[model samples]
Target: MYALLPVSPLYAGLALVPLALLLFTLVVLRWRAHEAASVGMFAAAAVALAAYGLSPEALSVASGKGVWDAVFVLYVIVPALVFYHVIERADGFEALRTRITAFTENELFLVLAFGWVFVSFMQSISGFGTPIVVVAPLLLALGVKPVYSVAIPLVGHAWANTFGTLGVAWLALVQVVEMQSVAATALALGVLLWIPNLVGGLSIAWLYGRWEAVRYAFPMVAVVSLIHGGGQLAAVTVIPPEFANFFAASVGLLALAPLAAWSRYATPTDAIERRPVMAESIAATDADGSSPTAVADGGTATAADAADPADDGLMSLPMAALPFVALAAAAFVTAVVTPLSDALGSIQVGLSFPEIATSFGVVTEATAPYSPFSPLTHPGTFLLLSALVAFVVYRRKGHYEAATARADEPREAFSRTVLATAIPASIAVVSFLVMAKVMDHSGQVLVLAESAANVATPATYGFFSPLIGSLGAFMTSSNTASNILFGGLQQQTAAQLGGLSEPLILAGQSAGGAIGNAISPGNVILGTTAAGIVGREGDVLRVTIPWVALVGALVGLVIVALNAAGLLGVA
Candidate 1:
């Protein structure tokens, strides 16, 4: 019966309705963001319930999955944002902003150069939306228009989306393909990224400010790309893939000398120039329930600085800087320091779904690893640690004062964090769960995969794989999910058609998922929101889609060339 079945085309088209509704409701109808999200959420849930034929048992299973998804988001995303928020509340972002602007005032240099380097750094440390979240505001503060601020990061950082932050995309790819992961193939993929990453860097720079600044900083751009791209590739092949981003960032940090040497053509440094001033008043409360009142700015105060007397109680720049620097260092150490990580591994939180899942023949009771021995180990833990450290640093420095208008309490911090991030995250989780359930119940992913496979010729698999990958990202709005859905299908088709090694074909799948993230509607929405250009998502898409297509095509061509050259041997 299964073999005789005609695949349902409706399932594929049906999957798009929610996204379309999002466009219509959010863009055309001009609904509030939350309202649009709510409508999409319910629509997806209805589809899932209807398509899946959810009985009590099935509903139970779906609920379990949804809860887990929410937990994952809460555990990882919420803390990261909270950490950022606490620092912001403490006036650390302002300090960091001054330091960056002081270093480079040219908008293009800040956007292109800083965007590439900083995005790469963040991706290596924390891959999921980290680049967009961190860089968008930084760009905004540097005087780039809010819209371009988000768009630039999305475009330039797209190439590294696969092997980034210790190869999350590759890890997911392994699950889908069910093959022994190849470090060499993963490394090769990262090496190949240099071409597109460089191109993306240049394109983003030119788009940000034309030839004025990027033209002058060409050598620095080249060196940064080479160091970052090369170091990432080397780490994956030589060390563990988990260490890829950490090592790359570490090495790239050291390459500042080479980058500096390459910029010898410039008469004087073209970086930002800021005046020195006294540190601002910092009034942030610590995790330990104490508020201090001495915050220092990263730069000196100047006559040109805005004088907002009402905000003088904010924390100093150095206090704010602690969290970011600490977070990066902790994440790096946690991934690399096996002894410390293993020790922290002792504090795991095992989640059990006993009777509820078994009644439905679904697996539950997955372990949520939480080892404080590796206190700074997980990305979430690192972010939390950074927040804690920021509190301490600021308090000790007298940047925070206990009796100065408010008490330093963890309750207030929790409330603000939940209000800002948790609400949005809940909406996102519900939407994704319903969509996944709908696709699974309707057998949509399988039908779509088969149809996609039948459409391509052997020579065109390279090109088509990326398109399929893009479709998956578009549908799911996640590179990880896209790989999970299509990686095996692409590998199987490659094997059947041309006998290509499964790893290489699977690698192609992973690569495509990475590129597709740039234009994915969900990513665009989140990025635009973070960049403060909410309703203008279509504008960002119009600019990003072409670049995404071009990069995917380039990756596809390389895959084809590799296959033809016998570089990826037929099994």
Candidate 2:
């Protein structure tokens, strides 16, 4: 394909038209993701037809393959969403919030709890802006300024995008690039992703209380970040990327308790306090998973907290966390347990695409087995299973009766989730997939990438790599989309550079897309809407853009350094 495409100025620039349209609609026009992707998809199809001599049949087959590929991600979205709302209705999030108060009374640490750990944990399981939707409100409710509320979680969850959402973005990158050395790319991504992990934690702390609080929390942050970040890199060496975030977060979650205890005695004097504003009737929970109370008895809150299951007494922290626990366990067992995974893997379902060739002789190959959907091994299966478990637990604990007092409430919630998320999610997923396919099949990707390789020296390309990744993410508001659109380009550019390692360069691309999650306009708008601070999107953007740029620059620099060092088997 690369050899077939003449990397001419006109062809390269023309090939970029679709991508430019997508980015403009998303960032400048602030069009909905579905709408922008629609424009991009059409633009790509038109360009392929007029510029690349693509045939209609080839385009149809390529688009069909995209639709099939989209199934893998969309399935994850619907089930994860249903599970999240089910847990929310169960007061599970509140219970998790209450549980954090047990760790420390430091308001800064509380910010860290919600912003760093909680959001990261949520991102690990649920993608599609769930972390910001779920966590920002909690932060706002805790008296953080609206901007800080959105900014904190926005920055906090960026690091989790690749391995998080059960490797939705990571899978997109690896599969699309179709690297000869999958493990090498995975490993590089693991280590490279840690840069954002550490940045996210510090950004949250700094946003909460500036340098003073960051200084106080520095020790805790470093220790936990090392534990989680280092653990993730190590996990990828053994386990797949899907399980890396889970393994890393679990290690951090356990290590945090000891860190909390250590903070008690090693407390700094004149620590910056994060004072809370008045909340509604719902009391802020204290440590030990107790709901807020009017009075404190011997450092223990004494009250029938409204957040607890009033009709069935307070739900245990473990019970409150049952869905997540079940999900983690299910993923682990299915992934590691051979018989179960094999049984599930065998039940494959997908569209089998026949090989098709464009008029320009660009051939999109056939897949004999096609895009397979493993019924049991798929993350969506676990999500659905987890949602079911959460429903049963929430019901048995009288959560339904206490809150809704209706038999069909659960059904309504599930239906509402499907109604709200299904269409938009489908539109966004399909549009990007179509655009990716059209561009690839018509040799547009090859032309653009080869042109880039011709234009930039290896060092300049290394520095610009993250910016390219960021541009894709900013346009689509998805790390997954960025990888789908540009991962192949990154891989091709690395090969064309003559001495660069594909994995090493790809790490920067992946990391940049992850970091860009914080400043993507769609994400900013989502955060403001979810946090109940509409029309104040500018404020949120103002606070986040600088941090995102700084982190993105550092990522580029790191990539350049690694490329020059010839580390990780750089050619």
Candidate 3:
């Protein structure tokens, strides 16, 4: 008996049913993420057992793996939320908004600063949808419409999905596929990803003011894209892939100062006052006489002020940014400093699973230390460190006030905020991961990829490759998971098609996975939950779906051209 189902259209269509149901619930039924994901998880389990010949033991193993993966992600999500709430409680967002507006009240600059630049930075250091969850509310506090706040960051930081988060996704791809030269593969992915990088910046501008915003922001966008895309490529040549996004995003952050100082962006234009992306209620309030700062803080003193007054004192921009600065420093010491990383990475935790096989012969090999996690070197460790640092600093500075005069009251408040946000987000992420694992372990993922590859000639395989990768991400809501799920299949397909370039195909797969983050339901949930619009995930998806489709198509074309031009090894 075959270890897996033979490639066939019927099986492939069956494999897609779970994802189809997921989309139906999320988009058509307009269900909440956690609710929809639970239904989809059950659907995936049913499909695996009924159509794919998944055994009970194998299903249990896959579900276990899913929960473990969810733990890894939640480690980051919970700490990040703690950090956000810690800052928000201190009125740090209001203070930061005030300071930023003092420098430039141009809505375009502000949007790009938070949505594009800052979100990219966050992705670079800490991904797993951390950037979207953290930055969406920051944008909201800057007075961006709630939907736009979540949607913009969803689109903005997606280009960094592969190499960001300390290159976890890229590392996953490398692990799954036996590439001839890792450097060449990284370089190829870097080049292809630049298109999305440039497109992301311009898209944020367009979202702000249509074509007019794009025209005005073109020069700045170009410059930032160079630093972001070009810098990452350059870093890949000299340094390890792990620090590629970190270096580029840090440079991009520094460049913001000079870019903001430029005459065009520094002077407020009529466009600033006519923010098409903002809510009409807020716009009218701005027109009537309310300062943009007041509108930014929820349109009244009682909203943000009555909750936590800034009367004590406003923190300077640097003071407000200290937690992030600490996060960056911690990441640098652990990731970049060779001696420290080695020492800290030595202590790792992982689980062992027995080899499990389905009746259809789909066998998942047993492995020791599967997906080992280094507690000291993991991003979550750094996030927690940063949170502690922020709490201590802010507390020392008298930034927090308690409703009750108890010493542990602040700790209680932090716990409540974290639980309120982290619980729903965790449920959704776990459900998505579980569904993806069931599909993978049961051979449904392979069947889907092979079926697509079966129909495409070598000439056309390039186009379908990324779509397969995107499908993986749409299901899993993670570039790393997408790459792991499809990377080997892509490699096998490339070899089977004698005319195809393995590196180009794999690059397209990774690039497509990166762009797929825009449409991932789990990521969309993170954004909506953080932005305080949990049920409106469909609203945000409406905006991001087109961008993902457009960019995925563009990536396909680029792969087709490169493959045709015989630039396989060079790219």
Candidate 4:
């Protein structure tokens, strides 16, 4: 048995008080995550200082660690988002949307194909709110109801979140559990989360339409759910955990082929009229041969009735999609073409700063700073390329005059990308950092994890572990942070419960973190903002809370069944 950290019972009790306050502040007082997090962190820090004694040096160490955590998010999300915005500003996204919609007008197919498959792909590539920001606007453009647009994507691809983007959250989980491979961990979690994920998908589909939509898509949804959930489990168990989301999303997309065929032949009971792409004003103006809708919107003409081909020009779908094609190709080369990816990744910057000797203990320092113009393997690099390509395409094919006029204007292009990508991305990053730092430094997180874990009997921690995992994610607003904060605690509790396998325990931790995204304050805010439903966070929460609880409960049951069946590999 490992030696446990020693502390007075009173101090331990006091250590947990911050957690109680965190719950009250978030659940009762209804504070934003940032507010609750700060309170929790300050309280935890104070308790640690009082019980463990103050350490001036620990401050530097903690701060350094916090910065490192922030950098990790910046490296991946910032570039990815910038990349997306660049393409968006170039108007390439519209072409891609047109091509996708041309395939089928079935709303159910569109939601599943784009909302689930495409969004999952985005999540696998760039996961910080990229899915909703990118997909929601596209859905809105596709004439999907704004409310359904906001909610469907938010819930549909959630399960893949933990292992997306090189399995950042899963990596964090394993790091906390001190496990090397996340295969077993992901498998265990995947098996447990399968039902909840299925239910979530069905629920989202239902919200998209109604009982008819659910009935129509049940078979297809099942196929998607199995492919997604099963593929994810298999990837973690057999393939690299880092590739789990990428692989699962790819497989799920493939499963859609048969489903699409089936839908085409299944009978035309609900063949709703094809939703028009443009709004009434734009469509009416285009039909009247007035200023081309694009020209009117682009400010190329002052007269409302002037028909200007130069500003109103629209490109063939392929022309606009060049940038995305390039992006996908580049991303694939970087991720799958081993030599290219390695060569680019090899040009990294790594440095170790002198450890600060302080009252807290010696803390190691490390940083990997890169030039702003990193290679295409960087998500930012691909995004930038896509943007530039998209801009060129937009100019050459659509608005020749406008293109020539803006050819030399780089700042305008930059502004376009920044407005679309940075606003939401920055907010998400700030929100995540604030929540993580507070949760980590505060004793509230530990107390909360312990409190949740304590709800189950020692023997039942496996069955109940996901709830504790949910609590950690809720507090931290990040699966990665939750894993960092509670992975060890969950594993230790499971160990004491009955030598439960580390993989199963860690899987529960990752699974809980994934589901928590639905209830996560940062995500809720982003979803609401994307849907232009700002200030309705409370309403969104009211809808999401029950789903979160249900998912957690279902996961708990799976954990229990697996453990009882001796299939969980409990030690």
**What are the lDDT scores of the predictions, listed in order?**
0.59, 0.71, 0.81, 0.60
lDDT of 2 by residue, 219-296 (tens): 878987897789889999998778899778867777766766774423333566443321311244445543344322
lDDT of 4 by residue, 241-264 (tens): 788788888788777667766756
TM-score of every model versus the real structure: 0.76, 0.74, 0.89, 0.73
lDDT of each residue in 500-530, candidate 3, tens digit only: 7788889899988999999987788777767
TM-score of 4: 0.73
Please tell me which predicted candidate would have the highest lDDT against the true structure. Answer: 3
- For model 1, where is the 10-residue window of minimal lDDT? 274-283
Worst 10 residues of 4 by lDDT: 297-306
Candidate 1's error at 563, in angstroms? 2.8
Off by over 4 Å in 2: 105-107, 118-191, 209-213, 230-248, 264-314, 405-414, 465-496, 499-503, 506-549, 565-570
Clashes of 2: 3
Model 2 C-alpha lDDT versus the unseen true structure: 0.71
Top TM-score: which candidate number? 3
Error of 1 at 235 (Å): 4.8
Candidate 3 ranges with C-alpha deviation above 4 Å: 1-4, 234-242, 272-274, 280-312, 402-413
- Between prediction 1 and prediction 4, the one with superior TM-score is 1
Clashes of 1: 31
